[model samples]
Target: MRESEYAESRADFVHQLRIAIKEANETQYWLELLHQADYINKKVLNQLIKTVLKS
Candidate 1:
């Protein structure tokens, strides 16, 4: 995420932001999958999901 801060151009900053968003979405997906598979409990899932969304 901090990569965007060091972007050399506005275009690069936007590109970095896009990459961050994509990664965040992927993290959320995995969290959901883990929750469904019972690898994580509701509390942990909620905490992680909240953190990801907040990012």
Candidate 2:
């Protein structure tokens, strides 16, 4: 995700941003799954969700 900040061109920036957003979405899905399965606490899940979507 940090790579997008230093992208050399607009195309590269967009590409990196898209990849980061996709990965963040995937992470959110997994986190939701874990929370639903009782693998993580609500507080922790909320924190993770906030961090993942902070951009």
Backbone clash pairs for candidate 1 read none
**In TM-score terms, which candidate is top?**
1
Tens-digit per-residue lDDT, 4-31, candidate 2: 9999999999999999999999999999
Backbone clashes in model 2: 0
Model 2 misplaced regions, further than 4 Å:
none
Q: Which ten residues in a row have the lowest lDDT in candidate 2?
A: 46-55
Evaluated at residue 12, the lDDT of candidate 2 is 99
lDDT of each: 0.96, 0.96
Q: Give the TM-score of candidate 1.
A: 0.92
